[model samples]
Target: MKQTALKRWFNSGGPGVWLSAGAVSIAVIMTIGLLAVIAVRGLGHFWPSDVIAAQYDVPGQESHVLVGELVQSEQVPRARLKGAGLPVPDQGPEFMTRDLFKIGNRDISPGDFSWVIGEWLKDQRKPAQLMTLERREWGNFYGYLVNVKEDGNVIAQGEAAWPQLQARIERVQGISDQLDRLEKGEIGAINHGIERLRLRARKLELDGKLDAAAQADMASERAEFDARYKAVESQLAALHADFNRDSLTARDGNGKEIEIGIGKVVHAYQPNAMGTMTKLGFYFQKLWEFLSDDPREANTEGGIFPAIFGTVMMTLIMAVIVTPFGVLAAVYLREYARQGVMTRLIRIAVNNLAGVPAIVYGVFGLGFFVYVLGGSLDRLFFPEALPAPTFGTPGLLWASLTLALLAVPVVIVATEEGLARIPLTLREGSLALGATKAETLWKIVLPMASPAMMTGLILAVARAAGEVAPLMLVGVVKMAPSLPLDGNYPYLHLDQKIMHLGFHIYDVGFQSPNVEAARPLVYATALLLVLVIALLNLSAVTIRNRLRDKYKAFED
Candidate 1:
């Protein structure tokens, strides 16, 4: 091929040469331009210098300014803090618990403080009060550690906030209730087992000469039984102290009862995670954290961890489910089966399946897996668990299986091409050396085709991660309280509901009641997913290219 190509190159001074050269040059230029544009836009998300910080205040009155020091305080002036009698700070640092500031707490939502510093400077009103100083920062006013409460020299404090009298009262009641239950013999004491064991030991001691090992075993059992009984007793005491009666009852200031109705406290608040963040500064420090964090009723500790987990799990499961079946099928077709009418028909069918719309698979999965198969299992195995679900519920397993079916054709096609690419001489030589057909197929063919198989897997992952409609039919919940796997009894709970990044982006952008606020997150999530898929493809392509290079010398 090299000699022929060299000969042709020397002979060719015609339109074909010029056309190919022009095409290559054009492609190179276009690719460079595209990369430059994407780099400018995508990397721009991380540059910190261009942050447009703003805060909100009264329209007419001049807002207070912080000229030299940026004050960070939860306390607004008593006059400005109250809104319609509620203690809502108008423009100040939000009150946050230590836990709320972490990367994990999705329950916390970001608040709005939109007034401009320039407004505070021009306005005759007092400056933005300095509350808390992070450290002794003298350069740029990063944030403030101390608020206007200048009276106390010791500003930073984390003292014990003693429990109120009512809380103590509740703890006493909780303990009393347990004591009453014990008195009434509503629950048997764990020590009854110890008493029985002691009586048994006494009887056995009189009648038998036990061996040393037997005596040690008996002692060990006694120790274990005693430990368990003590553990239960300790748990009862701890629960009484930890959750007072008030802990059971939810309430807010003013003694207003707080009841999270069936849907009332469905946490889906995505504040800063949403909204158009034109302020480029917001992106550099907190942008990625905000997007990948677990969801909140509002986007306070914005981390899209759940969404990332869901997307990765679904795609991985889809790959696991699809790869073997598709690759095996291709292997059999290429290695074992001879050319026949059936083979041609199967090929056509596989192609047709590949061409089928993704939504149809979603519907099929919903009907067959969720409705028929799941419904049947629910009735048979989990009749007692009716109304609630077991395997009969639409969830993670079904979603992955559905996507696997959808991805099978891609894997099959890639594997088939790979199988075809292997030279027939390699197979014949192996067989001639007395290697069995199965051995040749497995040892010689599959390893050679691995790179191509990986390419198929990459494409499959990309498709599966972006899928929304099919997952919607199955177990993709908008807000899964727990992940697919957890510290629960059954760690890998396939039946559990899962949050997906693809569907999450859709829900935030389109389905959210607060679409205006949620739109920015949609872009951010979309961008992250794109980056992930591209990385996956890139890795696969690198492997495929290396494989191709290695195999090049072996070909005819």
Candidate 2:
């Protein structure tokens, strides 16, 4: 009876159902685990970690104080330590524990990090006065604050200097904001205007229209631009003078004093003194900076706003380009075209195109879209910018178009399937009610299929947003501090190169000179990229759900 029952269950496909469920459950668990690991590694980076001030007592070597955050620790083979010429005892256990410390002061040391055997670290303590100075250059400074100076005169020293330094930093920050506005905003616009005038003059000269009157007009424009630039330059000089007025002296672990200009420091914090609430606030602040500020330290520090902006802008442009064309092709295939061998072949080709390698599309876009199409457009339209090649370059437009082409086949297949699902009786009824074939499609067929179109779009966006390979060949760069869209006359500059989150991850993870420092950033960027894709997909899914609800009556 038991054997018969087991055979009956197998015949009912119960085992296959259970196996499929188990597979799905395992996938979900693995995905969650991966995300959790990424979050812990990346998000923990912003949390202010207690700086360890410890004595390093190596056998037969003088002891020295080591100061910095305890970055990580691991047990390694003693043989590995011996290979590195470290004084590991030959009689000790085969595996020895090692700690990696971020002893920032890269200007003083060859590197900002050091590896020390765990056993050699003596008198490990977290001093409340230990300071961590986040700097714009040379990574970070781990030391003790000595004094605050103004105009080479000591303004505040001892315990009084910390508060004074904090106040001065706040004041400098306000001044810095003003300076940034003048530099990147007003001065940037002035420079852009000057370039445009120069380009205009060049265009006239190329067209054989640079007569005396034209020259005079161009010269007048150039003079006005120069006058504006000079005025801004004066303002910038004043700001710079104020920016460098204050400096702070700090003492390192060896009690050596070094003076750093206040302008160079981004932030100063004593992690050991910070309460949990204080650390939480500081963490959120750093997280905000990571999202909003421009990257520094070879793309290992600061925010990834440019990358986030580029990824969203490119995905949006790709969606706009792919949608109508994809829908049209699907309409033609499922509604208008004759059901013949040629039509079948066309469908087959499109389905196969969907499976083509993404990098292949990148190559095609570079060769056809950029070199051929863009070059032709540049020559025909921007003749004066010939040698420079305005559109005949790898940029945002080419990247978007490449992604659009790569994604269009998915849209076509999805939309065609949606159309095929629509009952023929609805189309016949629409026609019987005096609607033409085009009208029937436009009002009846397309409306009901809008949900499926959105389904395809969600998939396309999910794929395109995370794509790094094709973007690298087309437009994405390691650093594009200046965004593509700015306050210029043509606000949206599609021809400019852009920074993308996906490419940022690959660059920081693989190509960075500071491997250990950039490691956490890789995880953080990967997590952000996943969130961005999810957000994009969620938006499309919301729209799809709305459309499905709105047209539910027709489907029933």
By TM-score, the best candidate is 2
Would you give me the overall lDDT of model 2? 0.93
Off by over 4 Å in 1: 1-288, 298-301, 379-384, 542-553
lDDT, each prediction: 0.59, 0.93
lDDT of 2 at 397: 97
Q: Per-residue lDDT for 1-556 in model 2, tens only?
A: 9999999999999999999999999999999999999999999999999999999999989999999899899999999998999887888888988999999998888998998998899899999999999998899999999999999999999999999999888888888999989988999898889888888988998889999999998889889988998998999899899999999999999898999999988899999999999999999999999999999998999899999999999999999999999999999999889999999999999999989999999999999999999999999988887789888999999999999999999999999999999999999999999999989999899999999999889888988888888888888899999988889978898899999999999999999999999999999999999999999999999999999999999989
Model 1: how far is 443 from its true place, Å?
1.2
Tens digits of per-residue lDDT, candidate 1, 196-297, equal: 456456446655756677678778878987776676667667655443332112221112332111111112111222334533544554556555445664
Q: Indicate the residue-level lDDT of 234 in model 1.
A: 74
Find the 10 residues in a row with the least total lDDT in model 1: 131-140
lDDT of 1 at 53: 21
Best by lDDT: 2
Tell me, what's the RMSD of every candidate? 14.4, 1.1
Kindly provide the TM-score of model 2 when superposed on the true structure, using C-alpha atoms: 0.98
